[model samples]
Target chain A: MENYIPVLLLLGFAIIVASSILVLSWWLGPKKPLAVKLSAYECGVNAEGSPHAPFASKFYLVAVMFLLVDVEAAFFFPWALVYKESLQLGPILFVALVIYVAIFALGLFYIIKKDCLRLR
Target chain B: MNTVDIAILVAKTLLFYLIVLHVVPIMVWVERRGAALIQDRPGPNRVGPFGLLQPVADFVKFIFKEDPIPTGANRGLFLVAPALILIPASLTLAVLPFGDKVKLFGREILLQVADLDIAILYVLAIGSLGIYGILFGGWASGNKFSLMGALRASSQVISYEIPLGLAAVGAVAVYGTFSLREIALAQDGLWFGWLPRWGIFLQPVGFWLFFIASFAETNRLPFDLPETEAELVAGYHTEYGSMKFGMFMMAEYMNLTTISGVMVTLFFGGWHLPFVADAMLLKWIGSQNLLGLVQVVIFLTKVAIFLCVFVWVRWTVPRFRFDQLMRITWGRLIPLGIVNLLVTAGVMLWLGGWK
Candidate 1:
């Protein structure tokens, strides 16, 4: 708990710096808001369509795949730290990791087989 | 913790902030000059001697330019996005061990702000949060291009992060501890009386995977599809101006510095120069405080080299197509990272164990 003081202080400092600069800019910069100037920029062309339109399922697929692999990758850190110690204890832990990886690898294989990563 | 401990922590945090603030401007100068050198042109040479004061001029311009919020923009988010990016980038620096502890004034002082036990996990988790700035800024801008840019940035960061985390796991497997200070200390000796016992030598594949993923993670060229000027204009920050834009730019360079610092801490042996023995240095310096300062200097020098490499790569490589970026992350880097981790595990088992 004591180790976190600096982290908390650092966060406060960042917020202060960011806010100060922003406030400074607001105080110093001119603010003459014309109707045309405030409109969202669309590369010199008038804005078209809604920004809230639905995106492709591929992005969602990518996000799902990322969650699966990323969580799997997260497990590796703790496993790596204790892997050597566990190996000395017995092959049980090692085999457990292998089985865990194998299960995910099969999922990855299925995803690839389905061409889910393809950008259609 | 005592008063002295609190004092040291505060001092170290202040020092870290100053170092980051100083480095950001230097990086801006380097990027401009380096891009010029690579493209065979004069760049920003009019401001100060060799254009060293260009960042200062740019800073003044950013402060004075009017920041316009789009009429339909989410004003709250638009205002907070820059700071959101900057916070995590700065926070990631807290766990990085810039140098070993030094004795000063009858006590010991560490060069790092916070030397956490689970430094790697802390860094990875904080680093991933940086994408939120882009996401919020883009979505709130109410611009189609900004939204597209935000999507690209978030997806790219998320995809590459898997490989980055895995590569780090490979190194951790070899090093056996997540404490960055210990990892740096572990690489203190020579492997064969000639070669430095750096993480790069031991985990070459991990280093390569980390190197590529870091480029994507930092949103540099070849992976900077999010801000590819040919398509998205200025990308997520397109709706921003004045110091708001400066905040994003500063955050990017700060991220570069922090990432490079982490890379040096992990793969390049932190504060140890190749072929220089710590014992010899201790004997020569005869003061722990001075030696620690030397170590900090050494660490900064390595980070500087990495920063230069970042700029050089940015100028050299062309932006990858969005599809290419996704394909490379999911197809090549992630798979390679897994293979590298497996091989590392196999070797660790064969060696009996990691110390």
Candidate 2:
């Protein structure tokens, strides 16, 4: 909490800038709203059934799952950069990271074989 | 504080702040001009000398533009988003060492805002938070495009910041230092007194990883998915107008600064101008007085060069598809970051630098 000054300062700046922009845009930018214009844009086609229609879960599911594994793989990057220097940090951390990566990779392979990414 | 101290402090702060503001416009000019050259067209020639006043014209145009709040949007968050980003953008500079030193009034001064022991970690944490502005801006805008942009912004930042941190760890391993000044000074001389500058010569892979990761972290082209114009309109700030738009612009330039600063501190030797033939030039020119002016200039020049790179690439390279972006971060970059880290650690351990 004591060292929160920097974070706090940053938050304050964000709040200040965000508010000013909203106000300025409201005051200065053009404005015209017709029912058709306000409706969800469907790329020049007639109105869609609903703007908030539910999307198929598969695309998003694959995306999230990919991100999960993707993020996991990214975790290895930092550790790997420090790999040769691992003795200073702790010898076993490298081995642990290796095991961790192996397990993580196994999950990836399982998903790959299961065909989670296939678009049918 | 004494009168002299108070006067000096105020003068320094004002100068620093003003310079920070001024840098963005120069960067903008250079970017446009460089892009024009890259694309084989005149970028901006109408306004003033070398199109220098274009940013100023842009500022005037933006300020006069109307502000509009969507009828049912989250007004507070919409307004707060840009603030969140620009703040972190500026604060990261607090710990960067501009140069060795400068002298004034018979006293030496440090060119940095502050030198905390945990400078690197502070930069990482601050960098991570810059995304909140985009997140809030997009969320608050209440447009589907804005929301999509915000989500993409956070996701991309999270993915890229990891490798950026990892690459820097290799530098730390070899130098055994987290202080930016320490890192710069350590890289000052040639290995055999005539070899070359340093850092890049020793840790080329680490430098490349760090440089690439910084590019991606700043959301520049090839990695700029948050505001991917083709996909998400104008991205996070799609609903923004007037000053809110200005904030986004300001943050973009500042983020560019932050990335450049970090790059110089980590990879290039910061403010250590080579080809100096005189000892007095190194001594007198390095006093806190001369340093405050020289340090900022040196730093800005390095940053400006990189800003041109940003523009050059923006004009030259088409942005990656989302799948490709994800693949690069997850497959190529992360593994490379880890490998680089391991190699650095191995060398450091062998050299007894670890103990």
Candidate 3:
């Protein structure tokens, strides 16, 4: 691809920058530490159970749902801008947008109805 | 059909990508120093030449640093996630018209890559894909903090995209075109012979929405909760190490440049200055050599200044509380964008904008 040069350059630059940040930190920072310094982070609270103790399924479920909808929010931009361009098929475009919105709203409704986001 | 033309295109693109990345070292330096000035403290001055080479030092550091992979992390997805984000972030530069066209080896070479008719759509689609990298990076890292940061970033960007797009309707309505070059050209002359440029005059609301959303999309200071250290302990990259983590940081700055470029192109009469008509300038500078170079310089200078503004603001503002960030986007920005759209549409329809 003619575009390969730019693509490669971008990736290489990313690698270079990332590598530099860490390398510098290591050079300047003190390396002295003990088993306690690198122990599993426990927020200064004693480990009550195994680190892999099962979290509430609801936490994972709600988090996944949150991510899904947040992404769907981003899709609205292009669709809104181009909706008018489909004037010949304006009705179809309108319905499609409506369907997308409905799906989004329904998902929101489901999340709320299920009380998934409520921290309490 | 021609080898030289293809080579020129690739060469220019490669140059542009490298140059854009090189800018980060400067941007990072600027942010550090500027934030100090803004907050009233000394920034990074201990390193080479007022920390000019701090980024270079950082570059060496990351290269030699220990890359510790989390034991249970999904190795493939973890590696792929950063690339996923980096690829789209880089690829979106394709449609941007960075400068006026110039000559290379007697054949004309445009400053942009192929000017696809769906350039605007391509930008949106690719930008949308950028979220996946963040999502998967968090998900694959097997760190709760990373996952939460990714979730926050993902949600923040998505929420902001709506108002951002809605605000652009006025411009689309007026210009009846989606292409950035066309939009820039439409604003060439003064409003009734005195005003400076076009989009700002017509759709200030759209400009605000776009700018606000632009910050959120790039995951900057206020919208940067995704990586906010205090709340999430490095957010999505909490577990990322070595070059894998480097890619994420580089991509964020690249996005800063990209969004700033888009904002300049969309709102600020990109590459166009007040009273500097190209035809009139062509007469003085000669149609061929000097004018093209000047135009390119002017365009880059404009984009660079905006990028600096991005750094300036990042250092100036306190990062918004997560609730505050969400409130601004959904409560204020979205409603304002929608209202702006409605008003613009009504006014444009009245003025025969679609005509």
Number of colliding residue pairs in each model: 0, 38, 11
DockQ of each: 0.74, 0.25, 0.16
Name the regions of candidate 3 deviating beyond 4 angstroms.
Answer: A1-120
Best DockQ among the predictions, by candidate number: 1
Give the better candidate number (1 or 3) by lDDT.
1
Residue lDDT tens for model 1, B59-143: 9998998989998799999999998998898888888788888876578777788788899999899998999999999999888
Write one digit per residue (lDDT tens) for candidate 2, span B1-355: 5677545555544455456666778877887788888888988988998788998898778877756666546878766677777778767766677766566665555566555566777788787888888888777765677777777777677767767776776676666667777877776655556764556765788778777777677888878888888887788877776666777777788778777877877777777655432244558765445645665677778877877777878778888766666556656676677677666655655665533
Which regions of candidate 2 are displaced past 4 Å?
A1-120, B1-14, B105-107, B275-280, B283-288
Please give, for residues B86-139, the per-residue lDDT of candidate 3 as tens digits: 777877776677766777688877666545555566677678789999999888
- Give me the candidate number with maximum lDDT: 1
Residue-level error in angstroms, candidate 1, position B14: 0.8
Per-residue error for A7 in candidate 3, Å, reads 8.5
Candidate 1 residue-pair clash tally: 0
Worst 10 residues of 1 chain B by lDDT: B346-355
lDDT of 1: 0.87
